[model samples]
Target: MEYFGPNGDMYLATKKLKRIAIVLKPQESPAEFEIHFKRPDADEIMIKTEKDAELPHNAAIFHSAKTLVESVRVNDNPKKKRLVEDYTHINDQISTNETAIQDTLAYVNLTADIDKAGTTEHLNQIKELTVSINKEKRRRDSVLAAMIAHDWVGKREELDDLLQSDIQIQTPSTSHEQLMAMYDKLKQKGDQVAVLQSKLQNQLSWVSAEDTSRDDTFQELEKLADQLKDELDVLSVLENQRQSVCVGFLRSNKGVHKMLVELL
Candidate 1:
């Protein structure tokens, strides 16, 4: 169970000694904690940590520890609570990206011997993948920095809108080069429609192999790519110029136009 501290810090109820101990980890954040497990006294409460018990002066002395725990402060500290929530969101996104990177790493397909065949293309892909991951890490850090200090970005709303635009236009998963490479092959399939579709099926497996928790992998991008492939298949039957076919396909598919615009 969860409990709230007097200052809106969150605490998890845990067991330790005959008493209880709440560890203070996040100095800022939910502190972001606000957790305490302790034994009850008539007027005071005693809090403990994992290994060490507090002496007289070292203990946290709250006038009404009971009142603090019992009292509800849902609307009391909006700013701090919001900050805690945002911090959590940023961390979750970072975790999602880190997992995606690992999944992509498995698909890297590099051999121990550098001189192995097809190694150059795989190496280039790994290099590009590293650049993409680093770019995302920087973006994550910049978002956190903006949360803390917005002066560098001129206005907070502008930054917010910019990030919102990024989400709509360049979803985190869809922006990776590996997926882009797969899409490129589909877009420029030339006369080899069957070959392209078969190849894309294998590539789609790479995408489908990623954690389904990501919105774009199994749901959005895979669906979008399939739709685009169907369109391309029809165009290939018509034997239209590859360039015109790709461009025309984008213009006609209003649903995916915004997303495919970057590739064009």
Candidate 2:
């Protein structure tokens, strides 16, 4: 064996060995030792070493290539084995659940754009998918909760409650079909208002730019007034529809405010 100090400098002296005793030699300056077999037929090996040249306590000991082979009894505790197997199974299940959660989240993100521009049928599918995703998230949390409870005895109840809380998020009272129908109508009315406003602006520009007759000017003013009236009527209906959509969502869940604003 080669010796090393705490600073990792190698010592000049070295020794070669095969098998070593399980027990360490008792302390002695310039220590003398012998390696021997208990059997009468086996030979003994003698070792002489100086204490000053001892390796550091943390240094690793390596055996020679020709070391004697020995059999050792292994621990076979049934309870410990079962516990290890159970822990492995639980970890595998947790890994599977995590993968499922990742897949569900990916689907949710993928459908986000679709949710914005989807037809009523597609939107309905998205709504169902979201509901299913939430349920899967809850299930994942429950499994994690169970694992936490198994590991921590005193905080089981607290962890369980945190994971499986009774809080329920409300959904819009308006049915998907009704809400989409209203949205379509509101969009049509908004387009009409835009058209009327544009027409009124053109009429105003014409009246100001042209040197028209007084009767013609009066006729242009009347047409402007009619356009304004039509725009206002459409706007009033649009506002009512917007209010209905907003109230429908606000009454259900404040969390949906951003979504409603984006949709509008």
Candidate 3:
């Protein structure tokens, strides 16, 4: 069983298109995660550039994608040219490794079947093929990790742009239907308070300092009435702002979608 991380699909892309590649540099000892992004869709031009070595391994992919976005934003032609060249070279290596891996796996499977049939003829070949498979898999993984990193970075930029946009946030409001519902509630509370007042008046003859419990109950009922009045006031203000606030919210929502599509 092969375990793929969040960036797993990147590795799988190798078999489909010549869009991925990598090169080993034991001497240079690059970061744990380095990725290159090409325009996956042909309508857009693929941009490439050198990755920042200072970026932390966990953030390498996203940061690289930011750099690409910046390049597009600023139209940095010289940097864009360098990145295009690098992208091509890396993809070439990925394509080569992908082919090599596919071929080795096929041979390995063939040899394994033959060995199972009690043929000692392909034993050495199987061992060599297994080693080759491991090597090719590592190379493929590196390439895919890079692609996944680019995806993260691109998405982050889009989100950031949306958040930073100057969309005046309007407070939410109660609709006419909502206000009508609340008005009904307020009316019910008012009726309850009126009933409580009438009961207190009827029981006034029984009131005394030794038993002020009935008076206290009437006071509590009065407070509840005041609370219902306050709620009604707030609902009235919200109802007034409902149309404008809702329109503002809709505009802001559309703006977010527009900004995100621009990133793509």
C-alpha RMSD of each candidate structure in angstroms? 26.9, 37.2, 40.8
Point out the higher-scoring one by TM-score: 1 or 3: 1
Considering only N, C-alpha and C atoms within 3 Å, which residue pairs clash in candidate 2?
Answer: 1-15
Question: Residue-wise lDDT of candidate 3 within 1-264, one digit each (tens)?
Answer: 121112342222232343433332333323432443233422332222123211233133233323332322211246433433443454455456556656756766777665665334344555665676566545433433333233335576643454457345543653324423443453455455445444434443343323323445435434544444454455456434432333333344454234334444
Sorting all predicted structures by lDDT, with the top scorer first, yields 2, 1, 3
TM-score of 3: 0.20
lDDT of 1: 0.40
Tens-place lDDT per residue, model 2, 98-210, is 56656656666688666655344554565666666566544433433332233335654553353345235443465324544554565566566556555555554443322
Query: What are the lDDT scores of the predictions, listed in order?
Result: 0.40, 0.42, 0.40
> Best TM-score goes to which candidate?
2
Off by over 4 Å in 2: 1-173, 209-212, 254-264
Scored by lDDT, the top model is 2
| Better by TM-score, candidate 3 or 2 | 2
Give the count of colliding residue pairs in each prediction.
Answer: 7, 1, 5
> Which lDDT tens digits does candidate 1 get at residues 193-230?
44444444544445423233344333443444454456
In terms of lDDT, model 2 sits at: 0.42
